[model samples]
Target chain A: MKILVCISKTPDTTAKISFTDNDTKFNESGVQFIINPYDEWYALVRAIELKEKDPSTIIHLVHVGPAENDAIIRKALALGGDEAFRINSHPGDDYYVAGQIVNLAKEQHYDLIFTGKETIDYNGSSVGGMIAEFLELPYISLATKFELNGNTATITREIEGGEEVDEAALPIVVSCQKGMAEQRIPNMRGIMSARTKPLKAIEPVAIDPLTSISSFELPAPKQGVKMIPADNPEELVRLLHEEAKVF
Target chain B: MSVLVFLDQAEGHVKKSSFEAASFAAKIAEQTGTEANGIVLGEVKDDLQSLGKYGIKKIYHAADAQLNQFDDEIYTALIADTVKSSGSNVVVLSNNFNGKAIAPRLSVRLKSGLISGAVGLPDTSNGFKVKKSVFSGKAFANVEIKTDIKIITLNANAFKVTEGSGTATIENITTQIPRRKVNVREVNVVKGEVPLAEAELVVSGGRGLKGPENWGIVTDLAKALGAATACSRPVSDSGWRPHHEHVGQTGLTIAPNMYFAIGISGAIQHLAGVNRSKTIVVINKDPEAPFFKAADYGIVGDAFEVVPKITEAVKKLKGQK
Candidate 1:
């Protein structure tokens, strides 16, 4: 069985976010980037687990970004992947990114495709469903737990206030979230061997972005704190009613 | 250009977020000089006409029993078909679980421009530009969609629901529930006083409370204020709280009216999840916790002493009211 895991690099969780070029582009000066946790922790780790269980399962990692993302791809390869492919282009929208991936995955026809639920940077959880839609396969989003037996994949998806268990045949697409797998760190041997793993940069396909960003603005500045004495807990409730009117 | 809203349901009742979607659709329809309509799949128990209060002029409900269970593919096809028949050029849905699953597929099926988690109404002067939360609610962006058929999934509580005197007539639509591909086995529901995402009032805890045994300090306050309970990542990772309760970049990002943090030293990631809140209150022993910088109110005290006093004060205030 062949598995294709889509990965992306996002600003580190602790990285301070500031925009550039009048907020039309994200500022990258001195910003640290890492494999999106959802991709590295949930999607890729689960694929590695499947490969560990069945040695015949071949896992491949795919990324759609410029050359800077190659470092992130090598890190993903360090986790557990036969090869990594980077589509060297910056997509202005999620659909275009999905279009590039769909083009690549279509030729491979892998039995299973995996992606993080959403990138922490954009928080637009659309790529998985868009890929499945273009591919015309069953797409499950925000999968918390996934299991495979024979050709059937049973998935537990996180819904509004609960979770629902579902099953679909192979050649399916899944977007993973927190409970799908645990986080793994690359060790010395894994990092050293990752350098020798195959990392290919492919030419990009032409797809127009459906949407364009005009500008970005920071949320309104917060009102500084109003300190209250610990002994005056009652004053907090009174202020909640009179001053804030929140309660 | 007609506007259509997908009123998502759970346990045969339309969700509150769907109403917010309705108001949003109404805003677009009013702007475009069109009528706002709605569609509901499965067995919905609410009076369909009452949705008119939210400004929908008509409702197309497909009451097929099989449609009750969420199959995004089937629902996508159905919504696409309804859009074709109704001659609607715009679609609106709450950017919650169901909308997140369907919007992307529907966009591809209809070949339309899609916006997920829109926080502002579209500015249609030159082209259709909508403001959306980005970078996990830390920043906002104005995005332009150039497609004729546009799909928008609204963030929870982004638009306020306003009731008009109009009552929308129900139009029953016939849709074929195709052979199911994703078989649903069982559902595990967590019953809370308020759904965490939509809660206007929230009380969140961090690992400083120690363990699950000491969660009473957090819950006791939340129960008194009738607020939802949330946790920082470490607390959820330690298994002291459920993963859904984790309110950070990786968990659920929420924007409540009042956010009370206990024992949490706000990390940048954790702040990204909740910085959109209207007001924030932080209570902790350490005076230098980062959350205090973001909070509207701060009380430097131990959680054990501070939370109980606040809970009692809230209960006393409610009783007096």
Candidate 2:
């Protein structure tokens, strides 16, 4: 089985998000970039699990970014991926990113493609589905548990209210969420082997971006906390009804 | 110039978010001097004509059994083909799982500008600016769509469902159904009084509930109020509740009208998921819990005592109403 895992290099969760150059681009000054936690913890881990279960399975990591993202690609290799490919271009928008991924996946004819539900920075959650459509394949999002038998793969996802079970074929895309697997740190031996793994960089096919980010800004700070007497439940109700009008 | 709305349904029923999407599209149609039409992929048990109450002039049904289950590839292609046939300049969908999957796909196929998680109508007076949440509900961003075909996926429960009376015409459309490579073998449904995502009111508990044995109080209150049940990530990880019911940044994001959090400390991740709730009520024995800072109503009392009393009050009030 050929498994393709899409990874994105994003600022660490604690990094302060800011913009530079008249608010047109993300400012990366003094910010540390890491493989998106969701991709590393869930999607990549699960793909490695499948590879472990079957040695014949191959796990390849793909990213849409510039050469600066190679270190993160090497980290993913250190974690578990057998090989890595970096598309030599910054993803201008969600459409361009999805198009690049779809083009690559189609060229490779991967049996299964895995991605996190959404990237931490963009939080778009649209690339996996877009690729699925471009390839004319089934897609399951936010899958917590997945099982494969022959050509069919059964996935369990949490819907708005309850749990729903769905099945798809081998040539499908799945966006993984939590509970798929526990996060793993690379061991010494694994890190040593990752240094020898092949990390290839390839140029992205030309594609026009349909969208652009005009600006970026931080959210307003929350209002100061208001404390109420602990013993007075009626006061709380009154505040809700009269002041907040939310009841 | 008609507005086409994708009405997502599951198991022969329309989803709650679909109604919100329909109403949103109808408002847009009214603004643009066009009529609103809905497209359904599979068989639905509800009366298609009754959807006219939301200002839909007609409903298009592609009644293929294969579409009864969600197949993104087929759904995207069908929607793209429908837009072309109907000549719809504007497309609307609910920013739920189905919409999230198909919207971007449609955008790429149609070469249209797409905005997901829209909270309000676009500012048509200006080019085409749609307001959407950014940074995990921390802020808002106004995005402009430059393309002729504009697609907006409204957030679930963001728009109100308007009630009115009208008889919509139901038309059966014929289209070639794309072959799906995926196959569904079995479905495992979780049985409970309320579904977490669709519930207007939710009652959630955390590790402060002590143990799984004491969970009856939370469940009883949820039953009395006809609300969905949820747990903080800690509770779910501790095996007190299924992971599906976990609500947080790393978990499920929900926007119910009323959210009752009991014995839970509001972590930033948890707050990210539920901050969009219209009203938040927190009940905890600790007076200094962070949840109280964000709660519209806070009861600093023991859940063991406060939950039962609240349940009794809800039962009594519901009987009266």
Candidate 3:
């Protein structure tokens, strides 16, 4: 089986989130970056699991980002993949990013493709379905369990209040979330060998972004909390009804 | 051009989120000097005409049985076809599971600018700008869609659904139903539990509650307040709660009207997912749990001691004896 995993970098979960450039761009100064958790811990790791079960399976990682992001792609290769491709461009928007991934997928004809549900930063959750639409392939979003059988894949995905078991043929795109796979850390040997993996940097296809952020705003800071003593828990209910008016 | 709203239904019933979407679409239609139309796929058992109370005057119904089982590609194509024929300049839906599945594909097909997690109405006084939460609700962004045909997916519970005396005329439309590549085998829906997505109030517990055996604090309060129950990552990971009930950075991100966090030290991972909640009430034994900083109300106490009393008070206030 041949698989392609989509990887991207996001601010570390603990990093302070702020906007710069008149509140249009994310402030990257001194902000640590890591492979998006959903991608690394679920999608990429799941692909590596497939290869581990079947050694003949080939896994390739694709990321659409500028040159600075290629380092993140290399780090992904350390987890487990045969090769990596970095589309040399800043991710303008969902359309452009999905279009670039389609450019690579069209050429490679990957039997399966994977992406995390969404990036922690933007949380668009758009690119994977867009790619599936561009390719006219089956898409299952928020999949919790995925198992491949001969020419068909059985999956269990989360819905509003339940789980739906589904089956789709090969050459499908899955937007993975938690419970899809366990997280893995790259060992010393894996990290050293990742340095020498074939990392190809290709130019991105020109595509115009359809939407742009006009300005960013932060939520109003919470005023000091009204603390109710443990001895007076009933007072909390009164405040919720009379003061907060939420319940 | 009419504003189109895709009425999301489940088990032949319309979801509350879809009504919220309809209300939102009506506002857009009013702003654009047009009217809002509704669309529904699959068979709906509800009185479709009564939905006009939410402001949609006309509805397009494609009651194909196959559509009851959602397939993103098929739904996208069907919605696209409706947009083309209905002369809709804007499409609206709830940014829930179905919305998240089909909105992006519909955007690609129609070449429309799409905003998935919209929290408020468009600011059309200037340009077509939509306000949405970013960074898992820690911040907000005003995004401008530069396309003539735009799509907005309102996040669940962001807009309230108000029913008036208006009645809609339901028009059954015929469209070619495409074959779905993904086939669903079994659907196991939990019966009678409040779905977390559309729930206005939620009661969540964390590892501080300890074992699954002591989960009564969450369930009792949730029952009394008529709220859904949720859990932190640790509780879910430890098998105390089902994965579907987990809410955190890697879990579900919810924006209910009110959230109660019990015995949880609000980590950024957990807080980011729920910071968008309208009001937060945190109950913990530790004095310095990070959740207090982000909470609207705080109680420095043990969950076992405080939760029962709060639940009793809520029940008493609601006249539940």
lDDT of 3 at A185: 89
Ranking by TM-score: 3, 1, 2
Overall lDDT per candidate, in order of appearance:
0.91, 0.82, 0.91
Q: Estimate, for each residue in B22-117, the C-alpha lDDT of model 1 and write its tens digit.
A: 999998999999999999999888889999999999999898999988899999999999998999999998999989999999989988889888
lDDT of 3 at B1: 94
Candidate 3 residues B14-133, lDDT tens each? 999999999999989989999999999999899999999999989999998888877788888888999999999999989998899999999899988899899999999888999998
Candidate that beats the other on DockQ, 2 or 3, i.e. the better one: 3
lDDT, candidate 2, B68-166, per-residue tens: 987777888899998999999999998887788789889988988788888789888968878776556544566778889999899867899986797
lDDT tens per residue, model 2, A16-74:
55677876567789888989877999999999998889889999899999888888998
Q: For model 2 chain A, where is the 10-residue window of minimal lDDT?
A: A219-228
Give the TM-score between model 1's chain B and the true chain B.
0.97
Better of 1 and 3 by lDDT: 3
As for candidate 1, its clashing pairs are: none
Stronger candidate by TM-score (1 vs 2):
1
Best by DockQ: 3
Q: What C-alpha lDDT, on a 0 to 100 scale, does residue B316 get in candidate 2?
A: 61
DockQ of 2: 0.43
* Backbone collisions counted per model: 0, 2, 0
Off by over 4 Å in 3: none
**Each prediction's TM-score versus the true structure:** 0.98, 0.92, 0.98
> Which DockQ values do the candidates obtain, in the order shown?
0.82, 0.43, 0.83
Clashing pairs in 3: none
